[model samples]
Target chain A: MSKSLSYSSITKKIVLSLAGLFLISFLVVHLLINMLILFDDNRELFNAAAHFMATNPLIQVFQYVLFFGFILHIVLGLIIQIQNWLARPVRYNRKGYSELSYFSKFMIHTGAIIFIFLIIHFANFFVIAKFGHIDPITYDSGNTYEDLGLLIIKLFEDGIYVIFYVISILLLGFHLDHGFQSAFQSLGINHSRYTPFIKTFGTLFSAVITLGFISIPLVIYFF
Target chain B: MDLTLKIWRQPSTDEKGKFVDYQVQDISADASFLEMLDVLNEQLVVNDEDPVAFDHDCREGICGACSLYINGRPHGPDKGITTCQMHMRRFKDGETIVIEPWRAKPFPVIKDLMVDRTAFDEIIRAGGYISVGTGGMPDANAIPIPKRDADIAMDAASCIGCGACVAACKNASAMLFVAAKVSQFAMLPQGKVEARERVQNMVSKMDELGFGNCSNTYACEAECPKEISVSHIARMNREFFSSKLISEKEK
Candidate 1:
């Protein structure tokens, strides 16, 4: 073998796809757990869910893995984009048209916005809940939980923040729209029998995850 | 019909290039894109000026020798056709056509609208072939390949190694071209003996040559004169992974 196949572009893509899929799975769990906020009128269910997520031993370990996945995906993505830019040093002066999908061309753009959103998200909720301060509430039965539900609702009360949150989530949807099926493609999982279905499923997944996350803030602020 | 041609004018590989405007009048709409260029060159030569440089052969489009980025497209504003197959009728009178060479790090512009695609030949040399033993001709029916697999292989075999896929790709990735070459062999039983090694070697060469990674944009498929599908890329990915796994196990 003249070269190590492990470091080839295909292998790099495979690693990227695996990490992206892992992050996607984490998104589902995060969205479902956050959905509890919508139905928790008494403010107990959402706080309980947050407490369980913070306290669960298995989840604690998985959270670290999830963090690693995000770092790997973001770093690898930037590296690929930079390499791609270098590949074509001179660009065409006249822009052309094809049947190419618009979202496919703008993944790096969408990903950058999502990265900024993540920083804000971590500072507003994760940092405060994890290391900073949040008032703890105690039930009559002697169970005490952080008042995360109130914190989230209070954050959503700001119209500007809510708008920014909604826009970022929408861009996340744009990212996922291409990424959901793209991950499978990178893994070489394409098939004539399953590809159409996977494409449809990817679009639906993007919409649901985007709307699901967006609904939380909108609902909290409105009613 | 009259047209304004803004063609790249580079004297040599190392020199800077720019689009130089030329005019051609009373051109037939039925003239092929290359023929229009031929007319422009003729006028330039008659005026004791340097003719515009480009690549063309087998004017029928099967040779994969002609390449041009015309009017912001790899092969003019046509679908499933090479630049040689593109007709002037596709453009209206007085249209401005921008023609440039394929731009990629591995494919440097040798001159105006002529890029050195020797990198592709280098990749082919790496492992784009299967070894065969010299012996008496075997019966055609000796190997029974599934009809579907054979058809797909035939589809993949149609790729002419043109760099349009690279020219059309946003990342300048050669995944489609490499995938088509890999699939043409991977689908046939006769080539299966070296399938694992072939994919690994070709991909390694491609990466070494500085081609970008596939972003799954499908622009390559859309612009391929052969219309090679991106599914072949998936198969190449599968082959690369399995090769790694099998090699690891053997060690």
Candidate 2:
């Protein structure tokens, strides 16, 4: 059967790459804002950054795009994976792991776990900031903002929640390690000169992003 | 040296298959892997049992007919060579080797180890040719093609229609094989006219044949007897994308 013009394998690959990279960029912005916690002793700086992200009109518009990007990336990823699974109906009895990396083979596993974590993340923070009631914190400088930072700190105080957050961050890192370079390859962006660099950058980006996110729950829990 | 083989055997295509253990003794290590199989088949004939069935033509490794998944790798545990080119010396004395046919929905086994690879022919038929008038061969220098393009075209032309790329792939994708054909024609002047339709039709046929998507594992290159580059896959993707866009605008 002829595939639809818009959702062919090539088109799906291109969409996956572009949306994946957009989500990666969002990670950078998110990590930057999140890093404010490490800078100041109190929640004022972090709250100010969070408040800016929550209230800014431009970021708000982009936030919808970011959500759409995530859903698109995820749905396309599942479609490709399902078709891949059906392409080989029979299972290999003595399957070898010689040609594929762990991240490449285990993408679905990591992605599913990450999806659950994302729902929890949005529920705990995003939903509450937008809809649910949150107490206001008054600063000594006569400034008042939502006490979202204190809520985050309290949520991290639970060892289980902190552990869950750290584990999920690590899984996200594993997904990104293969994802960054694979996106470029799927988009037909490849060269002997730059591919190695992209692979290296992928690994480095995964580590930095995971470490940055993990530091938050660890710090808020123990310190 | 004596060797033990755990080879997959199925009575027919519809029935389930299982691994059958057989012993072959005093075979020369210098003999090719297929030659050793020939010895075993001879023994089976003497015992009044049906001999093992596998595919082969031009055992020197050029025809790309011999395909076997030996020890969990396509074309045996060697690099850049077909199963017919693999030597028995790669296996140690008394080693137990596992052999199976290509594992993919598109490649169904015809017998013990021979699979129906007509799906590949269908993909090629979809667009692997340049139409020309029925006349005398064109003059050699009439087209005046660049040397670099010809060389790369020749490189892409190295794919032997062997399904190792599909066998080696975790997803059983034929992207590398399809890509090689697409790139071979896309780089040539004679092929430029049908390049767009060639890639599109071939890709659609490949998809319709139930082949998987490329996940960039590079397994196809590693297992291919021709060592076809994965870059061809990327090039084909670029071609397919541009062709789709152009076709859409034309529509």
Candidate 3:
């Protein structure tokens, strides 16, 4: 009923795919910065990266863009799904087996899990870092910053949170399994000569992201 | 083959429908699925009962008229074939086959196994054709179409406008149908002239009719009688986006 609903579904899909791809790029940056924690046992390097992310003017602006991207992706995805459900008012008694990809069929379910994970992540880390009080550590030269690295380490040390985080990351992998190349397909970037490669890379990318993020919590908990 | 059958029976579009059980004896395996249904109808007529109503035309598969969700799949279990072309041999003796009409908001069932597919005609009327001035016939080779492009265009053109894609889609999206139409035109020089307007107009009409968005399940492609590629869908997306970008309506 909204003005946006008047736009063609293809237009909505274009917007959704573009927003999703932006968020995918953001995840790459976030994971790389978060990966700093594992390499440096002292936590100095991780804290410095976190400090730069919080204080840098460019990244500060990008933070708002990232938030907007996440909101747009969530809203449009739900809108599309709702419209789709409405399209089929009557349900079939049984569905025949086809070669439909399992992950593609369940994107919304996987996305819902990922969204819940994000909410918990934001509440525990983002809210505390931005709005709530977190104890700060000062360098020898008096450059003071929030000890986000230590906060992360402490949080991951909790067995339950670590387990939840790993499971959530795994679901994120499922979401990405369809989402990565689907973004390209929606954008009309599919090509017979290159689609196979893009699909292969997408699967590899999903695996890497899943393993990389899962390694963070697992390592923090066990080692 | 002796078989048990479960067929949907609806008195009218406004009336509630239900699955009605039927039995057929000694049907020939060589008979087409529609022919088997004809046998059942003959028995119904002999018993003074209402015959099962369904849609079929040019029972040889070229006509996209036949539509029935057999067991669960559109156009029955065999891949890349419509209901009219489906033979009874695909089912084992004594198997119970379930048949239902296509279910979608735009495609309402008029009666048992016969949904009004006029929605498709509506989409076609939107922008499915190219304008050609009345004159002498143009030479076939005048356009100088590349072989690869010609092949792909022919592939796109083969779409029978069957609603199987809609029935197969979880979302009941008509993207594959619209995409096939748009792609067929967009690939050729004659079609290229109106490609921008064609995609935009067709997509707008599709949305107005309340078809769902494509979720990329590829079920539509797998179930398509013509085996239409989803890549045409991607092409339609690209066409729609590029057209909207520079659309005069935006001004």
Q: For residues A99-202, could you state the per-residue lDDT of candidate 1 as single tens digits? A: 36568788899999999999999999899989998999986657789989989888899999999999999999989988888889999999988988998899
Residue-level lDDT of model 1, residues B111-214, one tens digit each, is 89999999999999988898888999989999999999999999999999889999999899999999999999999998899898899999999988999989
lDDT of 3 by residue, B169-249 (tens): 989999999999999888888899989889989998998898999888789999999999999999999998888786666
Query: Candidate 3: misplaced stretches above 4 Å?
Result: A138-144, B247-251
Interface RMSD of each: 1.2, 1.3, 1.1
Residue B27 CA error for candidate 2 (Å)? 1.7
Clashes of each: 0, 0, 0
Q: What are the models' TM-scores?
A: 0.97, 0.96, 0.96
Candidate 3 structure quality by residue, lDDT tens digits, A1-223: 6886777788888899899889888889889999999997767778888989988999999999999999999989999999999999888877756746678877889889889989999999999988988788887756777889998999998999988999999998888888888888899988989988988898999899899999998998888
Candidates' chain B TM-scores in the order shown: 0.98, 0.98, 0.97
lDDT of 2 by residue, A72-184 (tens): 98888888898899988877767855575568888888999999999999999999999998898889888888878878888989999988999999999999998888888
Give the range where candidate 2 chain A is weakest over 10 consecutive residues by summed lDDT.
A1-10
Per-candidate local distance difference test: 0.90, 0.89, 0.90
RMSD of each: 2.0, 1.8, 1.7
Q: After superposition, how far is residue A136 of candidate 2 from its true place, in Å?
A: 1.4
